[model samples]
Target chain A: MVLRVLRSMIGLLLFVQVSVASAVLDIEIIGAGEHQIPIAIVPFGGDDLLAKTINAVVMGDLQRSGLFRPVDLAGKAPHELSEVSYPDWQARGADALVIGSVALQANGRIEARFRLLDVVKQAELSGQAVSANGDQVRAVGHRVADLIYEKLTGDKGVFGTRIAYVNRQGKKFSLIVADSDGYNEQTVLAQNEPIMSPAWSPDGSHLAYVSFETGHAVVYVQSLYTNQRTVLADFHGSNSAPAWSPDGKQMAVVLTRDGSSQIYLVRPDGSGLRRITFSGVIDTEPNFSPDGQSLLFTSDRGGTAQIYSVPAGGGTEQRVTFGEGNNFSPRYSPDGKGFVYTHFINGKFYIAVQDIQNGQVEILTAGGWEKKPSFAPNGKLILFASEARGRGILATVSSDGRVQQHMFTQSGDAREPVWGPHL
Target chain B: MKKLVICVLLVNLLAACASEKPKEVAAAAPETPAAKETVAAEPAAVAVDPLNDPANILAKRSVYFPFDVSAVQDADKPIVLAHGKYLNEHPSRKIRVEGNCDERGSNEYNLALGQRRAESVKKMLVLGGAKASQIETVSYGEEKPKATGHDEASWSQNRRSDIKY
Candidate 1:
């Protein structure tokens, strides 16, 4: 009874978190990168409100990454290189500084010019002008942050990328696509049925997902541009786990029509169907390798659910995970060196990654209701589903297992989160 | 709605008991008018459909299973068999078996497991003389739950297959 009362209290708290304008997510970050770069971002010079909005986005992105530490401005605001006092930043212990200015162009486009400087060297590292429409202030900010991140870390930034997940509230379900920071949520589909396993196409133009609108599990491919959807797989039994190939020409889907759940490949236009895995058992959740030559899937043919790999052209299957616990939802890294999956052990679900060569497994999150892990396009972070305070939320852990973040939606339980490809 | 039905059934049972007491009290009186009324109501009482009768096994539609196991256990065999026999006798009624799972595994894995569970019950129904054409199976996986708790008490109830007509 006390637990029930506590859950109701949490429900009330979550209800109050909902805003009137849009469905905003509350993000809580934990841990930090090994080496933190102390950087300072000064507000842009022109368009005060727009500049503040963009600066907030850039600052939030950099801080949430767990890599950069925000250096206190202390009333020091410089919007251009000529106005910056190098010795002032140096004295403030800032290794790097970012200064920018925003202006509304006559063509109604907003342009922001940013510069990243090295305090120690007393030299400019990189400078670029990013422009977007007035309404896309966040996009402009993300672009600026990405440029700064790439300049400093030598790794691609995922600030401009998108993610898709299912938001379930009672009997209502919605397939939502949102910005990487959990902003700008757009509902692709909403209905009074369950939706699961949303897989983004390699090009990010479409999403293939499983829906129960037809009274059973069926796969559908819907284009984000036109909002047109077609049945990709509507077999007699359950059709689910639609995974797109790297080339975007075909997809692998799990179907139970031919007997037990088996993996099958078919074209995106719902033609050229070919059965792939002959495992007459529960062989599902097929994910394509980066090279598109193999598929990593979960199967129970070995008496327990484990990660297995089979050639894309249909060949001998090899077990990829072993010992201790059952693993599910195996997704290959962009580098194709290892794979991340859900590791279930002792009645707990953990997000774990296994190396293909050494067979070494690294547990990322401190085990909870974490499941269906997929890597970011840059292979720097892994996103998955997690439960907090009796609600399902989206969570991510860095590849090194050092940084972690939890994103709570405004309402409903978020599940089946998949990071979109690099745009 | 189910509780309403049970309440109505209980009231009718009590009224029948109250009416029967008067008949039993006058057992020594031969050819009583109350005995004639009882004889008249016997056929109507026997005419209730077994599927609608709470006392019959056919009224029970759900078959429960252990975690990760799809086979119909001995405890639920009679329920499945009773439905199977009823279908075979009627030859017109059809049922859809929906399988569900506890929130333990990945959604996709649980989906396949639930499908296997539904198919297992369908196979048993077919073996018990129900035609394959009379049965259709689907899996809701861990999406729908009969219980909302996270403990074994709830998980046990969630891992089940319901026969819906």
Candidate 2:
């Protein structure tokens, strides 16, 4: 009977897979912590299949975080709170222990209950239960992971957030949205021409991106829920680089219709055109600050590409980056303290973050064609695009540069990653 | 005016042939008439259209630029000037200048750089006598590449401004 239930649950999960046979992005960690938290997640007992699935997910999430090291249980797992032997976990050098159980309710739903324990104190830190259908098991797992992460780190977990990126397979390009862990990937928009620079709306309901379907680069805003898209900036010349303001009321775009490419702000519905940057040289790639008072963008007016900031209402520009290397694609962090940008130096590109207050710079990733660094809503991880094995892949590094992870697709290149807002 | 000058030259040669025909008729009349007719048609068939001629500078449509540079080079200026002259002569003709860039750096910044490349060419065309209204400029940025390789050889070709009539 348990085997039958397991088969049915797996079948339901398979049915929920995206239409394309897209292999989930395989993640490889590098430069993880030297002193990781030693934790043990005992296998849950009831409804064996569901419990195992949830346990694996929670364990995987914590391990991928590079902060926790799950101890080898060797098949000895206690499911109930009373069954947990604190001495066993302490003997195994575990600082924390997680135990959970799943049971099939009478209404055909699965009820998952979990307890997070502090092995040192031999006391239960937190306990919770969640109910979900077979189709929602994966979501419940992510939620459980989120709860565990929050309880451990004192920060809200980003496991439940989504990411949007541009995937290139040969001549075809697609805008894909996937779970924060790179699972359940769905192609939101696919076309033969290039689709790039996907910026999620502040509310995470829509995406503003550049599409070349009309034979030239044009900006469009599309609703994720309704699949409806409106042409935001299809000017006479190239209309590219659409960035959303914090209020979601306006978008800043790069247009060449008026002689040279300049940054312009337009309403989401394509009205109220206002020019922002007045540089005669290239001024593009505009991103709004968290407060929407200033705009950060790349400009070559000083002869080399550098990041500059101008008031959102259009005013004198202030150079933000100064150094030997060129800086581009600046994105403001969630806290608005500083921004992360792609810096080119010594023939290689690296992701670097700058402090707005002190003008100090911290180089995050090592180097190599890294572009489009975006901060996760939690501001813990910075997602960017880098080449791996000669193919473009999405990668993330902890903001502190302690942990690094690379997410690779099976057959194509994935670039231009943007973390969606917390929904 | 060049076409009209060729037409006038052809007419003058025809008149000279006609005037000489009477004297030729005194020697051999039938052959002289056919020869005159052939001579009258020869120049018209051989006259070349400057725009379509391979030797004309206007035939060169692309202007290449150095890496990260949008200023039109001295060598490519003549090609732009030739097109400018042609556009000036044919006031009704319209041309579009499309700028492109090599695939490097930020894509949006490339768009602005490509536009600068195209506008630089457009500015020269205007200076060389073409009206601003007769010229339209657009930048494909790094999106449209003439060559797809990752090396300098391909990038040099990709960084260009193409004039299309």
Candidate 3:
């Protein structure tokens, strides 16, 4: 009950968070030192209210990065990136300057133009114009951030990717997908019954989800590009969990055709069936390790649910998580150093990251009812579902806990977001 | 509450209104051979309501689970069984079990774990004599949840198979 009240409060806060315009803008500042970049984002070139909002969101984003500090909005720096006047910002201890313009375009599109200027280096680091639909303005901000991130880190950004989730609507549920920045959502599947798991193929071109539409739990892989789908498994006794093989040719799932649920490898075409788990009871959730040499799953052989690792070819198993909680749903990072899974410990469920090489684990959330954290292909961000304001919402936090943002809207309750592998 | 009430009323009225309209069309058009067939099939098409008929709903369905866990303690069981029986008798109706978890373990492990929970319920229902082929199961592991609250109650609610009938 207290949680419900807290969610209402946070729901109001989140409404304000997404609705309120930001005062500080994120400006790129390339400098010589590893020290934080001091930035001055002057009033944007177009639309006073929108510029302010953009500036504030960018400012908050950078602040959360812990690598930049915003200069005062009142600082008198009458310089724009169009003409080089680095001395004015440099004199104000500003390491960089950001300037932008927003224009409402035809066909309900928006054009956001941005330039990152370095005060000390006296150079323009990057420039780009992004076009987005009216419903995608917030997503445009994330794309702008992606550009800034690429300018700084030289790595691609996942800001354009989307997360798929499931939300219970009374006795039924809806499978929803939304942008990483939480905008332009569409319901892919809505069943008055229930929809459970949703997994993105490694290529990000298809989705594998579990649905009870057939009066039983079954795995179906749908090609997002074509809308054509094939049933991967529908075993008689129990058929669930469709793990897309990294190669996309096959999937490792669990089937209870023998009257007991066991891990099985089945061809994507529904041709082959091979059982790997010999356990007499409860061995499930088989995820492919990055190397494809091991499978991470859960088994009750230990008398309770715990994370276990076994050879990909099917062999003896070893327990990996012995912490206070019983663990399930282990997803190995693409890089394969460790794994991320749900931890049920002390009667609380949270997304935790564990290093397989060493027995190290850490919680990756600030607070408030978080579950089902999946990593972006870059492995730098974790996306999970949470309840805020009496509705399920998706939360994105930097994997290192450096930046956190909560996304929920009145359109519908969003839950169980799985980050697509690199797009 | 209002929505549910409206849905039930609308479905009932539509079904009832549909029954008379088809018969009138069939009787008047029976002179045409196509009309005769249409008239002949009116009675067959208006058999029973999906929700109101128990024998129809209990005809061809069951639930599944993993190996040893047979208690049906997972919260989704009660909800799924209702759907299972609904489809069992419907005969033409079909659905799938979407199993999930609370996001605590490995993806592969959770997949199986979710499957076990789903299959466990399925097996119990089969022994109780629900049709085997009428039910299919899918493991979503921790990839999906019915409730998003991070607390134990919410997680427990999420860690089971969802009935889609």
Highest DockQ scorer? 1
- The predicted structure with the larger DockQ, 1 or 2, is 1
Q: Encode model 1's per-residue lDDT on B39-143: one tens digit a residue.
A: 333222444655666544466789888988899986576567657766876799999999999999899999999999999999988876799999989999999
Winner of 1 and 3 under DockQ: 1
Q: What is the lDDT of residue B57 in candidate 1?
A: 45
DockQ of each: 0.67, 0.41, 0.22
Alpha-carbon shift of residue A206 in model 3 (angstroms): 1.0
Off by over 4 Å in 3: A1-38, A42-70, A75-84, A91-93, A102-113, A129-140, A366-368, B1-69, B72-165
Off by over 4 Å in 1: A1-21, B1-46
Candidate maximizing lDDT: 1
For all predictions, the C-alpha RMSD in Å is: 10.1, 9.9, 14.5
TM-score of chain A of 1: 0.94
Ranking by TM-score: 1, 2, 3
- What does candidate 2's lDDT look like per residue over B1-165, in tens digits? 322323333343334334333231122111112334344443322244446644344557899999899989865665676577668768999998988999788777777788788889999898767998998777777766778776899999989999999
Could you estimate the TM-score for every candidate?
0.89, 0.84, 0.67
Ranking 2 against 3 by TM-score, winner = 2
- Per-residue alpha-carbon lDDT of model 2 for A93-202, expressed as tens digits? 99999898888888877778889999999999889876667556666677788778889888777776788898887788888887777776777888898787899999
